[model samples]
Target: MKAILFEAPGSDPIFTDVELAKPQSSEVEVTITAAGVCHSDLHVVSGDWDIATPVVLGHEGSGIVSALGPGVTDLSIGDHVVLSWVPSCGTCRYCLAGRPAQCSLVASVVAPLGVLHDGTSRLSKDGRTLHHYLGVSSFAERVVVPVSGAIRVRMDAPLDVLALVGCAVATGVGAVTKTANVQPGSTVAVIGCGGVGLSCVQGARLAGVSRIIAVDIMPEKLELALRLGATDAIDSSSTDAVAALTEMVPEGLDYVFDAIGKISTTEQAIAALGLGGSAVIVGLPPTGQHARFDPLALAEADQRILGSNYGSVVPQRDIPWLVDLYLSGDLDLDSLVSARRPLSEAPAALVDLAAGHALRHLLVPSI
Candidate 1:
C-alpha cells in the first residue's frame, strides 16, 4: 500500500510504498477513503512532539471496513467508520470510570511506542518495520486499527466530511459542549481560528451562546469564523486580543477556549474570564511545556482552568450525534473543507497547513 513515510522529525514526509500486515484478533483492516491533514500531524513531523521515526503520520480519517479480525464481531466488512486515536480497553480503570479518552492502555502503551496494544508494528517497507502514528495511521491507503479505534458511523455520511469529525470536529466541538458546558446565551471567546478553533465557534453557536467571539492573527480566518457562526472577530496581529476581549465583555466572558495550545494563549484564556467563568484548554502543546496562572485569582473569582483532551469525547456516542447535525444542515462541514488533494499532495498540504494557508485539507487516497 502507498503511504506517507515520515523518516524523522525536521524533514518532509516522503511518499512511498509500504507493506501492511493483516489485522490481529482485536483489530480491523480499513481501506481508507479520506484523511484530514491536521496540525497535530504537522506537530509530529516538525518534531514538536517526540514521536518515533519511520512512521505513517495521520490520525483523522474515515473509511470502509475491508476485513474483520477473529474476535471483531460487532463490525462487518463494508461498514463505514471514523477513526479515533484514543482506543480504550473497556475494563481499564479510566474506561470503567466513564473516561475512555484516558484509557490506560492507549495513554501508557499504544501512543508512546507508536504500535498496537500488543506492542508490534503492522506496517513495513523493504523488510523494515514502520511505526504507526496514534494507532490509526490514516496517511496510508489502508490501516490496521484496533476495533475500539474505529467508530462505526452512517454509511451514507460523506467520507471526506466524516474525516474531519474524527479529530478536529470531535476535539473542537467536544471542548465546548462536553468539557466547558457553555450555557445558552453565555458569552464565549475562542483563541486561534484554525479548523479546531473554528469548530469551537460553531459549537458555541450550537449551544445557543449569544456572543461568540473569534480571535486569530489571520484576518481571513476571522472572516471565515463569522461565516461559520462567530458574532464578533478580532485580529490579534493588529490589536491586543486580551484587551480587545476585555473591552467587549466588561466583566470578561462567561467561557473562554484556548485552541492554539500555546503557553501565552492558555494564560490569556484564564485572564479573559469573568467571575465563575471557565477556561478550557483544547490545544495540545508540545510535551514538557507548562503554563503559569495565578492561583489567587482562580480561587478569589471562582474561575476554572480545565484541560480537554480529544474534547473529552466518547467517540461512539459523539460521532453519530455530530453526523446527525451535519445531515440536518446544522453543522457546516462543507465550509470547513478548504481543499482536497490526492495522497501524493499530502507533503505540500502539510506545508500549507503550517503556513496557515489552508483550513481543513483532506487527502483523498482513492482520488
Candidate 2:
C-alpha cells in the first residue's frame, strides 16, 4: 500500500509503497477511505511535536474494516468506521471510570507509532518501521490498528464527511458540547475559524446561543463562519478584538473559545469572557509554551479556563451521534470538505492548507 511518510520537518512527505501487517489479536486492519489533512498533521511534519521521525502522521479519517484480529468481535470485515487517534484500552482506570478520552493507556501509546501496550509497531517500511500518530495513521492506505481506536458506524454514512469525525470536527464540536457544556441562550465568541473553529461556531449555534461572535484575521474565514452559524463576525486584524467584542456585549460573552493555540488568542479569549463565563482553549500550541495571566483578573471575574482535546469526544458515543447530526441536517459536514484528491497529491494539499485557504481537505487514501 502507498502511504505518506514524514522524513523530516519542512520536507514534503514521500509517498512510498510499504508492506502492511495483518491484524493481530485484539487489533483490526482497516482500508482507509478518506483522510483529512489537519493542522495537527502540519504540526507533526513541522516538528512542532515530539513525535518520532519517519512516522505516518494523519489521524482524522474514515475507513472500512478489511480484517479483524482473532479476539476482535465487536467489528468485522465490511463494517465502516471512523478512526480516532486516541485509542483507549477499556480496562484502564480512566476508561473504567467512564472517561475513556482520558485513558492512561492511550497517553502511553501517543508519542511513538511503532507502539502499543505490546511495545511493537504494526506499521513499517523498507527495513525501517513507522510509528502511528494518535493510534490511527489515516495517511496510509491501510492501517493495522487496535480495536479500541476504531469506531464502527453505519456504512451508509457519507464516508468523506465522516472523515472529519476523526479530528477537527470532533475536537471543535466536542469542546462546545462536552468541554464548555454550552448553555442555551448563552452568548458565545470563537476566535479562529479553521475547521475546529468553524465547528465551534456551529456548536454554539446548535446549542441555541443568543449571540455568536466569530473572530479571525481572515475575512474569508469570518465569512465562512457567518455561513456556518456565526451571528456576527469580527476581523481581529483591523479591530481591537477585546474592545470590539466588549463594546458589543459590554459585560463580555458567556463563553469564549480560543481555537488557535497561541498565547495571545488564549489571553484574548480569557479577557473577553463575561463574569462566570468559561474560556475554552481548543488549539494545539507548541508544547511547553506558557501564557502569562493576571491573577487578579482571573480571581475577580470568577472566570474559568478549560483545555479541550478531541472535543472531549468519546468516539463510540460521539461519532455515531455526529452521523445522526449529519443525517438530521443538524450538522454540516459536506461544506467542511473544501477539496478532494488522490493520496499522491496529499503533499500539495498540505501546501494549500499551510497557505490558509481551506477548512479541511480530504485525501482519497485508497482510491
Candidate 3:
C-alpha cells in the first residue's frame, strides 16, 4: 500500500510504500477508492493539531469493503461505505444517549492508532512504525478502520460525488439541519465560503431558508457560494461583514453559522444575532483556542452560541438520505467536486487545497 506519511507538522507529506494486514475482529480493511482532500487533513499535516509523527492523515473518504474482521457480520465484502472522522463505540454513555460523536471511546483508541496500533501496523517504511491519523487514514490505497467509523451507503451512488459527504458536506449540512435546527424561511449567514461553508449554504437552501448570505475573503469562493444556493455574497476582505449584514437584516439573521472556527468569526456571529438568533460553530480551530463575546447582549437579546461537531450526523441514516437528496433534486453533490485526479496526484491536490482553490479534490486510488 502507498500511504501519505506525516513526518512532522508544517512539512509536506511523504508518500511511501508499506505492508498490508488483515482486519481485526472489530475492524474492516477497506480498499481505498476515493478520498477527499479536506482542510482538516491540512490542519493535521500542518502540525497545528498535535499528533504523533509518521502518521497517515486523511478522514473523509469512501471505498469498498475489501475484507472484514471476525465478529463483523453487519457488513459484507464489497459494500460501499463512507468514512467518518468520528469513531463511535456502540456501548458508551454518549452512544447510548444517541450522541455517538461524543462517544468517550475515541480518546482511548487514538493513542494506539497514533503509534501504529495492533503492536504492528500494515504501514511502515524501512522497518519503522507509522502512526495512523483519525482512525481512518484515507490518504492511502487501503486503510484499516473500526466498524464504528464507517457508514454503509448504496453501492450505486457516485463515489466521487459522495466523497464530500464524508466530511465537508456532512458537517455543513449537519450544522444547518441538525445543529442550528434551521426553520423554513429562516435567514442565514455562513462565514467562510469553503467546502463546508458552501455545504451549509446548500443545507440552508434545503431547509427553505429565505435569505442565504455567504461571507468570505475569496471572490471565487463567494461566487461558488452563490452557485451552491447563497442568495447573497459578501467579500469580507474589503467590506465590514457585520455592518454589511446589519444593513441587510437590521435585527440580525435567524441563524449565523461560523464555519471558519476563528475567534473573530465567532464574535461576529454572536454580535450579528437577531433577538432569538443562534450562532453555530463548525470550524476546527487548533486545540485550546477560545473565542469571546458580549455577555450583556446575549442576555438582553436571548442569543445563543453553539458548537457543532461532525454536523451531529448519524452517518448510517444521514449519508443515505443525503445520497437520496443528491439522486433527487435536493442536494447537489456533483457540484461540490471542483476537481479529481488519481491517488498518485494527491500531493498536488493537497497543495491546491492549501491554496484554497477548490471545494474538494477527489482521489481515485484504483484509477
Please say which candidate is ahead in TM-score: 1 or 2.
Answer: 1
| Residue 128 C-alpha lDDT in model 3 | 79
Cα lDDT tens digits, model 3, 1-367, are 8877778776778767876567787788888888999888877766667777778778889988899988898988998888877767778798888877666666566533462223445556678777767678888899887887778888778876777888998999998998889999889999998889989999999999899999999999898889889999999999999999999999799999998888889888887889999999998887778888888979889888888988988777787888888888788777778887887777788889888777788888777
Q: Write the per-residue lDDT of candidate 2 for residues 83-118, one digit (tens) a residue.
A: 888788888888888778888877876545447546
**Residue 247 of model 2, lDDT score:** 94
The residue pairs that clash in candidate 3, if any, are none
How many angstroms is residue 46 displaced in model 3 relative to the true structure, after the best TM-score fit? Answer: 1.7
Model 1 spans > 4 angstroms off: none
TM-score of 3: 0.95
Residues 254-334, candidate 1: write the lDDT tens digits.
999999999999999999999999999998888899899899989999999889999999988898999989999899888
Q: Which stretches of candidate 2 lie over 4 Å from their true place?
A: 112-114
Model 3: weakest 10-residue lDDT segment is 111-120
lDDT of each: 0.92, 0.86, 0.83
Candidate that scores best on TM-score: 1
TM-score of each: 0.98, 0.97, 0.95
Clash pairs, candidate 1, are none
- In order of listing, the candidates' clash counts read 0, 4, 0
